[model samples]
Target: MEIDKVKDPATVKLHSQVEMGSMELKSILGYDDQGLVAAPEKKSSDEAPLKVLYSSGSGSFNRKVMRNTVVHSIRTVVFSSRLNLLMPFGPLAILVQTLTGHHGWVFLLSLLGIIPLAERLGYATEQLACYTGPTVGGLLNATFGNATELIISIYALRNGMIRVVQQSLLGSILSNMLLVLGCAFFAGGLVFSKRPQVFNKPTAAVNSGLLLMAVMGLLLPALLHTTHTELHFGKSALALSRFTSCIMLVAYASYLFFQLKSQRSLYVPVDEGEEIHSDASDDDEEVPEISKWESIIWLTILTAWISILSEYLVNAIEGASVALNIPVAFISVILLPIVGNAAEHAGAVMFAMKDKLDITLGVAIGSSTQISMFGIPFCVMVGWIMGVPMDLNFQLFETATLFITVLVVAFMLQEGTSNYFKGIMLILCYIIVAASFFVHIDPTAIQDKPPETKE
Candidate 1:
């Protein structure tokens, strides 16, 4: 078919627009003829109908494209919107458990309910970041990224659940390093096929070093605690822990300065194929920013809900543990961490599936690093303030587990490339750690000891 014979109103208008020197319309239509003469006609008999329709600027083509876009957007929302829709379950779980006094039911519902609520917190913080500019946005994201774990730990610590808090911290580190990272790699591998997912190797190396340092910071205190059990009032242990917390907090602050000010590029992930050129004139159109007030509102609502759900979760722990036949160590180390970081885990996996390995690594590995550097120490300090004795004195097994997890993860991420097998290996390591915690029952350990023996 010829352009003149096409007999479409939009196409005719498009042609007229092109004649009137509309470069945008011409570029969109891919129109060219002998160095800008008459528009080209269909040159191939095998041309697809939709392509031809689109090229002809037909109304059907616009409708079809609009329909496809709308459908895709709806699908994305439906899949992701499930979490927002289930937000009420957090409060409902609290209410039901309060009314019926069924700890098991309350625990289950709250656990399930908090997943979406936590995810929404991330969404809210991210939205808030868009308005706060990079520096403040980064701060907001950093502060609230682990709010779930912080809130849960604070509540547990207040309730005299020190063991639960300790185990949950350990679980959070292991889960992020092994389970979350592995899932990201596996999903990315499947998405990209045989090609290895690439990321900023130098940045990963620096993060690995920081993570190792954090693990050591945690390990040394635990080692000291193991050696000196006869100290009067355990004051020696508390002093050392407080000192380490102060040092760790200082280190965390320096890290913030480094990431946000001194060496920012070392922290930001730049994809291999991304264009580096910038158009200064188009700054406003380039970035998608949101409203600060709206983000704050969401943050408030979600945080309040998370607080309610966490309360229910904390209250039901003892009963849920006995009813489920799961040890406190397992619940704290495995279940709590998983639930706390559910939003991050989902985000990492989603990014991996999209082949955005750099972002995936940041979400998974960077988060684990934050947990080690910030969340754990924040809790320790909070416990100190409340006169609750929280320390980094993890059990021997936990120390060993953390050591191995950090070491193995560091090795795997050294190359800044990932595959399905690597992901599987990480997952297997996490499962092994989890199984060990489940089977290894310590009767004398305060944290492992339950209030009531199961019948």
Candidate 2:
């Protein structure tokens, strides 16, 4: 005789109820039918909340499954771009440093290696932003977008290469405002030759204002040093630099609050035509290629590799300058910024070509604002902690160049419209800046400065 095979009716009903409850719980926890988290969805106020309870084992199992999925996605994230081909340069740079004494080669390799990683870092950040809301995402972009320059500056500061740190930072701002923005304008003008490319004037105005403010902060310290108006000679310039940096940081934070919170509408694209185009483009919208956790992990890994490569690059700066017969100023001001910001430059130009000048401006002008108001000042504070004497006194020539660049950019942005001519002018101006730096000598270069000690 067979055992009773029929299930109790109450038992079958209870099992079905449990399964339904499990599905509801998964949905509430952001999982879809396959137990994978779906793309972020807007919650409706009218939808009833579902309540479900689960044992600890179920929670642990869910976490394990998620962890494994993220692990497998690593390959997708790493091989996502053709740029990974340059990743080998990272190992090559390290190998050159270990096996050879060619500082120039090491420096060149390191620079090439960091290019792809820098771009990938930005890619990862953008992917991660799919999960974080726009405000936080904007902040993340601001931070990581300049991570390369920041990391290099830190390494240079540690080695008492304060001038390198200052010049490189100045170069970043100049590159973004001039080279990147100019290229975007030029590309957009060519692509939309029949009509002028327009962007959010209010947003551009705000960024220009911040750039001018940064210029003022830098100018005063240089002026105090040059005009000998400091109350305490050498110490006064450093003191003012630190104080002004603190104020600038606060101002930047306030600006962030305004942009991301208070007056976000001012930054939104206003052209109805552009809005239609944007909506149409949504059909080709980019979906996140990797999970949020995967993005985070890749970012950490890329940043760490960049940091490692930066150390080698920083150590080779002077050596490379001598071996390559290039001025240290040129290397710092012209070469480094161009390479470090290659990703940003490409992104801005692409947006401009798409007639999305607002995004182009945000990429170019917004980056300049972040570097000037946030990155430079943050470096000053870090240097202060390490007693590196990293002040805002970027020297007379450098300060004048920065001031002129800001003025020129501010003028270009006044109309909130751009053409190839304006783009050409900006590019010519940057060329002048680069050529000037190539010939210019920093009287207070690392070799001339006295050794730094902790205060």
Candidate 3:
């Protein structure tokens, strides 16, 4: 005891506890001292300083990521094309609307503004599609590609511009089937002058059949009205139109399921000649410029802006018709569709030039099918909910135009081959349609006038 230095039991216990605590702390801090004489450890660096540095670095990192996202989204969407030059027209249109009563100028400016926006909208959708995979991607393209027209239709519907909605939707189908597809075929043929361009025949046939079905959906209503053979007079025609719309919507849903799920192979892009290697290489090289979330944000912003401009555009239609000395029929049936479809038109032609005829057909014929099968019926349902009397009765002239157009397109696509001659014919057919609309007066316009009293 005298040699070892005896201690009190309580003091020894406390000392042991302190040593145990020190060892645990050292272990947690990754320190070790063994098999040597231990030197006094320098004071551990202050955790406060390290923590402050880490926090600041993390904050800066977050900021950098956010900045990159913004820059990338802007560069991809706003600066991707020369079409962006038209973007200023959006703000200018608003200014013109606010400052003056020049509805024609406002309409023109709004039309120009929407061109870039529509193209960018499609671009954003395509970027998003890269994330969604091909099946959902095709649906996204169809939906957003028609978004401009849909927005305009909604605005028109809200204003009780029923005829405008009908004609505009009809025009969208016509423009896609004729003008966009024609340009695509024409451009592709010129580029591949030595051979004919080919697309997926089954896909084209399916789209053609769907277009014909849509024609029937529209035709029956017009015929019912014109023949005065409705079971309940005026009320019966409206009822039939609503019922038919619901059925058409169901058919479109099934078609989408077929294309996306059951028979997806039918829609795969058909590459021929030298396109196979080039397309494969291009697919490998293709990378999305914007992230998925960024694509979504841009789509929302673009759609909202489109809705705003579409409001202005719809409001200006009647005024612009009077001020510009253009017939309302031509404006609704020809001009509006062309402007709304600028994105689809450009994309179809570009793909065709690359000899990707399958994609071209999807952009053109698929769009026509969507408008007829989905867009028109969806509009009818929307109107029903809104207590608006939107219907499939496109009048005799419009319905007949649609019917013949479908037949012509169906016949042309039956061969599953396209050449510049076929393209020229389609283009000529569209020109004739445009000319007819230019001179044609809307029956609804005349009907809206007060009947004259006998002098």
Give the number of the best model, judged by lDDT.
3
* CA deviation > 4 Å runs, candidate 3: 1-56, 131-135, 273-280, 283-285, 446-455
Look at candidate 1 and give me any clashing residue pairs: none
Model 3, span 1-455: residue lDDT tens: 75445557767888999999989977656567562223233234456666777687778877887898798778878887999999999899999999995888999999999888888876776677668754465556667678878888887788788998999999999999999888888888898888898877999899989888998998898899899998988887788889999999999999989988898787886656445456667776457787899988998898788778877887888778776667788888899888888767876776678666776777788888999999999999999999998989999999999999999998999988899889999999999999999888886773222222111
Task: Rank by TM-score, highest first.
Answer: 3, 2, 1
Better of 1 and 2 by TM-score: 2
TM-scores for all candidates?
0.75, 0.79, 0.82
TM-score, structure 1 vs. true: 0.75
Model 1 spans > 4 angstroms off: 1-80, 83-85, 123-142, 229-233, 275-293, 442-452
Cα lDDT for residue 332, model 2? Answer: 89
Judge candidate 3 at residue 17 and give its lDDT.
Answer: 100
- Per-residue accuracy of model 2 over 1-455 as CA lDDT, tens digit each: 12333456667888999989998887677668764545454243223342122343468667887888866676676776798789899899889989986898999999989888877776776677568743355456546667878988887888788888888899988898899888888988898888788777888898889999999999999999999998999999999999999999999999989988899787766474365466657445446778788888887887788778878887887778777667788888998888778757766776678666776777678788899999999999999999889999998888888998999999998997899888888898899999898777777675322212111
lDDT of each: 0.73, 0.80, 0.82
Q: Please report how far candidate 2 places residue 375 from its true position, in Å.
A: 2.0
Q: Would you list the clashing residue pairs of candidate 3?
A: none
TM-score-better candidate, 2 vs 3:
3
Q: What would the per-residue lDDT of candidate 1 be over residues 16-122, giving only the tens digit for each residue?
A: 87777766665555556445443443333235776777678788779987788666543433356766677667777878876898888888888889888777666
